[model samples]
Target: MTTVTARPRAGRDPMRLPVPRRVRLGLLVVHIVATAAWIGLDVALAVLVFVPMLDASWTAVCHQVLPLLFWPLLTTALLSLVSGTALGLVTRWGLVRHWWVAVKLVMNLLLVTLIVVLLGPGLADAGRHGRALAAGLPDVGEVPRLFMPPSVSITLLVLATVLSVWKPRGRVRKT
Candidate 1:
């Protein structure tokens, strides 16, 4: 005859030892939703919203709205960065083990840096100066400025997303 043990059970479920699917799904959903929203806002801010403000003789409004986008943009960017990092670490989708992931990480870093540092500042300055030009206010400078960084940052973002989706293996695959 066998004697029963006094211990009820282990402290935690064995399944919990593995990463939860819901956590991964939540991260993906949040990243996708935020990304889509950010793109929509970018287009809206650039074409629909800001242009209308300019049309309505509210140049100052453009400046206000333009700067306002920076906060959400920064937040989404930060979320994307954090979630992407977590996903990379947890899933190990060849991120740490392979070169492509490293490349992608570098690309993402450049993209985020450009947006966080370059694009927003350029847009803000241009918006303010452009608005002033639109109005009768004194010119900050005679030269016209363009927000090229945003365009470049968006391009990098799309490229990185495509790379992540397609997972085009460069040297790692052939080996």
Candidate 2:
């Protein structure tokens, strides 16, 4: 009996599959654009959060407008996450291969989780409250704190962007 082993092709490493440069570039572009969109959405939300302070009646209007942004915000966040993960997997960085990439992956995951679990429901509640306010009903006194979500999201996103740009840390040492 003979045992045979197949070897990698000439000049190619079996462990490192080559991803097309164009495909990687496209993924990078998508990741960047999606991240920028998410940041923009957060900025818009922050601006809306301040509206109530300026005009009390605009509070209902701002809250009503907030729900409309939910879908777009979610879409952008998911796009950024998916594209970033794809880029990391396809490129030299294998998701957790590098410290910066790993940190980014964690931040992205956390942001997405918060968006789904907290932000979505908060937006819905704000919309409902807005509707009630517009209906002339007495204030239910449950003013949803809208500032924190966007503020926190923006901060994390900017930090992620910085990590991406700086790529400060080296690869994670294998145990």
Candidate 3:
């Protein structure tokens, strides 16, 4: 007796598990919401940073409130990263298969790393300075360049969003 087994279709890997349509949709929603939230946080931060420039008296208040956004910003960022990664893995675009997806992934990773390594500590220091300023203490030093972080993050995020909508590049060539 002989037995026959079905083979995967051409260009499809047998080991690659298929994701359900509903699950993919869910992931897409999560990714969109998280990305939007991250952008919103950056916008708020940008406003706060700008306020200090317009009115020096608001500096202490802005700095004090800026630190509070750290956790939420980090949370949204992480969510965006994870959802985007999962979407890439399960969807046809793949994590690194398509050029646009690959670029977005790299951007997300870089943003997340910057948030953890630079933004987090910077916000904490700002909070401390704000407290010192509020207490009328001398030698609080100058506030760090708060504009850079949000400005850079927003730019990269908007670029990523544009890439998602345009999907400009074709698939990366297999080496």
Candidate 4:
């Protein structure tokens, strides 16, 4: 005679059941939303604000172009970082397990630092002083090269995104 074995639940996997299903799903959704925000903000800032400022005239200095953009960029970066960190810590992507997450965290921190410490002030200053400096210059280029930092910052941000996605092999993983 054969005997039938009892099951734990109706539709649950008995083995390989570590983390709770709800927690896993919550983390996944949060990460997905955060990633989308980062990508969207990055693209919009690059194409809309920075690109136009490539040739912004002095008359357009106080046009609320770059100043209007800083908030969005800041918001996107902050949200993405916070949510991503939440996922990494709560889920299996913790620093010890997934080195990629660690690298991304570092990069995101660096980006934030640069913006807060360096770029944000500079942009504000440029917006404030640009009009006076460019007051009477008939030539277009006299407005000052405002586009330089934005270009660099935007490009670096894009690169950071790529690194997050590609997640190249880091030093810790080879061993």
Candidate 5:
């Protein structure tokens, strides 16, 4: 009778499973594209928020543009998270194995949460108040709430991208 080994074959690394090459490449491409899309969308939203400050005349147009961003941001955020998770799982970079991946995962999750809980509603409120402001009503206490979060999100995303590229040392040892 032939003996069977419980562990992975001698040539393969234990943490890095043998995923098909094409699948790995596809996942990486999707992850990268999604990340770019997410960052782009956030930056666009930031610009839109700034428009009203730059020109009071543009308030109505900004209000119109802001609502359109909601869906793209939501979609790209979800795709980045899912594709990144899959990449981590299928590659040598197990999700929590490396500090960078773990941090990115947490950051992305927080970003998603912020998008859902804070940013979306803030945008809607800002749009409503913007319309009112354009109509010559008092300001809507809008400066602090809407302007800051998108910048913070963009910063976090850029940080995550740096961590991904740098892949700094600090691996979580398995117990």
Candidate 6:
């Protein structure tokens, strides 16, 4: 059973919450840490994807290393998403209150969705190809496809980071 209260459209105190300050801070910390980790892993993946293009031997190393990273990156993405959403709900920054926050939310969701649906399978296939190449199997396909999403995602995450810090104006108007 739950009780519903009418929330004022414009005058609601964003900080009026059942959550404590430290808890909110903890969530923010976790969100930041996870986001940073996610970004770092993506950047590393981008580099690994490029390394083989420079030195053929790196292909074996990349394949051996990349598969091990899948779980950590996935965990970080999920943590950042959950913690960020919780922060938005609990703090003055309502989910859709400000344009930047809304954009961040949408972008983050897209990134996470891409990670789960597109990037995972693509990387797995890339790893398989890399392994085959390492074993002297001829004619592995272009590796660029494996790198594209993370490259784009890195750019997207950077934009999101900028939005978080800048927090430009333009709040959504209430009806």
Q: Which candidate number maximizes lDDT?
A: 3
**What is the Cα-based TM-score of model 2?**
0.90
The alpha-carbon deviation from the true structure for residue 23 of candidate 2, after best TM-score superposition, in angstroms, is 0.6
RMSD of each: 7.5, 2.0, 2.1, 7.9, 2.5, 4.0
Candidate 2 ranges beyond 4 A from true positions: 1-17
| Models ranked on TM-score | 3, 2, 5, 6, 1, 4
RMSD, candidate 6, Å: 4.0
Best by TM-score: 3
Lowest-lDDT window of 10 residues in candidate 6? 9-18
Q: Candidate 2, residues 1-175: lDDT per residue as tens digits? A: 9999999889764545478889899999999999999999999999888889788979888888889888999999999999998987788667888899999999999989998999999999989988888888888978778899988999999999999888775888999
Best-to-worst ranking by lDDT: 3, 2, 5, 6, 1, 4
| Candidate 3 per-residue lDDT over residues 15-105, each given as its tens digit | 4458888999999999999999999999999998899899999988898899999999999999999999999888778888889999999
**Which regions of candidate 6 deviate over 4 angstroms?**
1-16, 140-144
Q: Estimate each model's TM-score.
A: 0.68, 0.90, 0.92, 0.60, 0.87, 0.86
Candidate 2's displacement at residue 59, Å, is 0.5
- CA-lDDT, candidates in order: 0.62, 0.89, 0.91, 0.60, 0.85, 0.83
Off by over 4 Å in 3: 1-6, 10-16
Better model by TM-score, 1 or 5?
A: 5
Q: How close is candidate 4 to the true structure, as a TM-score?
A: 0.60
TM value for model 5: 0.87
Residue lDDT tens for model 6, 23-68: 9999999999999999999988888788877887788778656766
Candidate 5 local lDDT, 21-45, one digit each (tens): 9999999999999999999998899
Span of ten consecutive residues with least summed lDDT in model 5: 137-146
Better of 1 and 5 by lDDT: 5
lDDT tens readout by residue for model 4, 36-140: 665665555455445445665523454234556567667777876776776665654464355666667777787777667766765565455544445653433
Q: Locate the minimum summed-lDDT window of 10 residues in model 2.
A: 9-18
